[model samples]
Target chain A: MNWLTWRQHRAQFLFGAATLAVITLFLVPSGLGIWHTFRSTGLAGCLAVTGRDCGDLASTFSDRYTGLQFTIPLFMILPALLGVFWGAPLVAREIEQGTHRLAWTQGLTRLRWMSTKVVTLVLATLAGAAVFAFLLSWWSRPFVAASDNRFSFGVFDLRGIVPVAYALFALAAGVAAGALIRRTVAAMGATLGAYVAVRTGIELWARPHYEAARTISYSFFGSGPHPGSGDWVLSTRTVDRAGHLLGNGQSLDFNVLHARCPDLPGPSSGFVSKAPIQACIQRLGIHLQATYQPGNRYWLFQGIESAIFVGLALGLLAFAVWWVRRKVA
Target chain B: MTTPAALTATALGKRYRGHWGLRDCSLEIPAGRISALVGPNGAGKTTLLHLATGLLAPTAGTIETLGRTPGEDPDLLPRIGFMAQDVPLYRSFRVREMLEFGRRTNPGRWDAELAQGRMDRASIDLDQRAGTLSGGQRAQVALALALAKRPELLLLDEPLAALDPLARREFLKALMEGAVDGEVTVVLSSHLLTDLERVCDHLVVLSGGRTQVAGDIEGLLEAHRVLTGPRRDVDRIEGVAAVVQQATTDRQSTLLVRTDGPIIDPAWSVHRVDLEELVLGYLGQPNATALPAPRLARTGAEVSR
Candidate 1:
């Protein structure tokens, strides 16, 4: 069974190797170039320096490599690509070609055939995703140094063990969809769609809420919440002396400002100016506050997200085995 | 102890989404005999073969091949070889790889010598991809895979469909050579009666999702005869056990009847029926029963008829 799986999937392995080589050709130069610029511009030292804010210098250096941001996000599609190309066709191709009859009747059980192919492909997917994440993490190091933020959407998933978990989920989803649908092209499409949906759905609805966001407050008119710099600020709001809620961007109206600080200013075009509002807030002892997931929790969040994806992957694979064994031909 | 049948099914039935593909089918093909499974389209012939392979499970009753239920026991698979009608092979694999696949998959039972001989006899190119091969080559490769497993019972569905007349003759000749001297029991299902008659010793006829007639060919042939006489009621004929087919002109009535004894009526002439005529006679009238044999594959040729 193992021999058959390898013989059948050798073409896919070769394609994967060639694809990795092409990606390496592109990653090596950009990574080195970014590293060189960071050193030359003195921002590399600031990555380790803790005394002062490096935001200005970091932004200037990072802006020079704007092309890096665009290209790196493209790697995010690798998981879905694995699902479509590797997972969807694994079993679908066999049934579609009517070779399941040949494979199942050759003294080996169907369960063995399914498990062998799935296990072999899964090991390969994990190894490939791990290697990819390593290169991506290495290449994006200067970006991390410049931004001091690892939780950025496109950037975060690219640099951690979560990508490996996502790869597993994608591959399993593909295989399960293939087993259920029994059509290679349709299963491939479903795998791609499901991978993207689950990934973005988790990022948008599940990740931030893994733990409650911590709150930090600052005096009005002062440099506000520099302590929340590396964290993901879900929202920033103003609170009064008594801790009454204030507008967040548009949470409060100009009428409320007029009612509280009547002598400050009148509404212009249904909006109050920020200068007077800042003065009124200072006069009232209102505070600016940020709700965020702390940057120090990066690895913890990575662990948690990886657990969710890997759990989902295992579930999908289990469902696939059950479907193949019980429901399918 | 009596030897167990190579393949047997009791009240075997399969139902698809909205209709039954096979129903109330019970048959036992004896060991060491080549059997022909004959049926019209939608007659459950392929369904019976699929049930034997355990590819499609029986919905109603049990089907046992080589004395074990397929799909329930993994060990039974290697013991029963099956050639599906379409001759589905791995299109991407080279002929060499397919043989390797058979060898690797069937581990202990695989006969590498027999496989190589089949390849050589067919003059198959080892380097060529199966997808690129001609239809004849594909069928040969399929057969080679099934045969090289050295199964005790081989179920072949439409195995000779893709071959030419000469190839068909050679194929039947090969099957005759295999089953006559070897331990393998082959059940070949095809519409070509001539080809089947050349190789098969036992017979099974399926129609309307049921077994119409099943017995040894020679015995079935012997028990049935065509009687030409004056047009009269068949029920009045004392020697005839059952009427399989009836045709009449203005003054003459010809009846094909299954008899337990010789037709001795002076008014009628009895002619021994051929294999094709016997099968067609049974098939022409779906309701005809050839007087159920003692066994599914029983040869009652020693009887008076």
Candidate 2:
């Protein structure tokens, strides 16, 4: 079986490697440019707001670096096309060409012939996915680190471990579609459609929940000084000027403040004076904390998603195996 | 008589979408005998061949090759080489590659020298792509692939249908020479009666999904006769047991009669039918005993007997 598969796909494997090399050459310069841009701008303190330093420039770079996002997805698309154009035609072409009859009437069973093909293609798909994932991960690190926008989340979210899952899923889905459709063109189209839908669905609706759970916010304002204070008379409000909540802005009214600051002893005792407005105003600076952090959760989510997709891929692979085994031609 | 049967179909039947392709079509070919399956366009000859070779599953029957069911055992496949009608081959593969593929996949012991000899006799170039060959040349290649397996039984569907007379004769001569040792039993189907008569010893005639007549070629011809006379005198013919075919116009009548006795009628003339006439007579008859099966010897029976 291994020998047969190797004979069948040796051409495609060589072609795939050449294509990957060309893509890598193009990506290297682009990756270096991204790294230089990141170095020229400050690492942490770069202002990413108002489309000047942080918001618009960062968004434009993120969009330009969109090619990095496409690397894994594009690599994944190759296997599906292989399955459809090359792999799907594996059995059907034999039957269509009437070579299968000759082969089957020999000592080899139809099941064995199909099994060899699927196993070989699956291995190829994995190897391709692994190489692409490694290159994309290495290339897109600087850009991924620089961008803080939610849109950047979609592009680089599946970077480290998730692309593996995406690739496997795409491969399995392509093979299954090929088996079911039995035509090269139809199988390719179906595989692409299914991959796009599943990947898009996961990124848009399901991924944000992991990041939303871990955010924190804070705000502050200045207030007048108290007469009985020992050294300084000046005072300040901890909250913003309009009294709006900060750090991912959720409102912090009196009830919320009291609930959070229940152990503050007497508010007036904590302050120099017992003036309620002044004491309350002094403690008005806002702080909000969430349990889940986006970056940390991103890896966890990637790992979990990869596992789920891997399982789905296995299921699809099993179906493809079963389908090939039962194939009549 | 002690040797194993080369091919056997026991109550083999196949149906496609409620239409009968083959039904209760049972046959056995003893080793060394050249058997021919003669049928019309839709007589299910291809279906029967496919079933016998395990290319298709029988709807309700069994096919055995060398005492083992071909469908149940993959090992049996290599022992019986088959050439399907129109002989589809990979256009990209040269003759050498095609033969190499056959050698790689076939489990039986193949004689490379013997295959080369057969190819040489058929005048097929090893370097030419199968698609580039003429129709007759392609047929020769197909035959070469089957012969390479050195199979115990070879099933060919319309082996010479596309060949010119000269090529057909060459193919038959080569096939006869190849099977001279009586190790190979052949069951081939052909619409051309003369080709079957030249190479085949036994005959199985199928019409409308059933075996209409089957026997040694000589025996089939000996039992059937063609009678031509005036339309008014057709019923008056005497000493005839059965009429297999009858065509009546206003002026004259022609009848195909089957009988074991001598024809002595002065008013009617009886001519001994050839295998062609006999097969045509049976095929022409609407009610010519579906599966008019003849007794055949088991494997290793003498062809002359």
lDDT (tens digit, per residue) of candidate 2 on B10-121? 7778888879899887776666788999889889898888878777778887777777776668677768778888887877678887777677666456667777877887
For candidate 2, the docking band is: acceptable
Worst 10 residues of 1 chain A by lDDT: A220-229
Tens-digit per-residue lDDT, B50-121, candidate 1: 889887888999998888898889889888888888788988999999999999999899988888887888
* Deviation (Å) of A175 in candidate 2: 4.0
Query: What does candidate 1's lDDT look like per residue over A171-278, in tens digits?
Result: 999999999999999999999899989999999999989898888887766664344346777777877887778765325566777779987666664655678887
- Taking all chains together, each candidate's TM-score versus the true structure is 0.93, 0.76
Task: Give candidate 1 misplaced runs (Cα > 4 Å).
Answer: A222-229, A242-259, A267-278, B1-3, B291-305
**Counting only residues 3 or more apart in sequence or on different chains, how many pairs clash (N, Cα, C under 3 Å) in candidate 2?**
15
Report the lDDT of model 1 for residue A46.
Answer: 72
lDDT of 1 at A321: 83
- Which candidate comes out best when scored by DockQ? 1
Candidate 2 runs further than 4 Å off: A1-10, A36-76, A148-158, A174-180, A197-300, A324-327, B1-5, B230-241, B264-267, B290-305
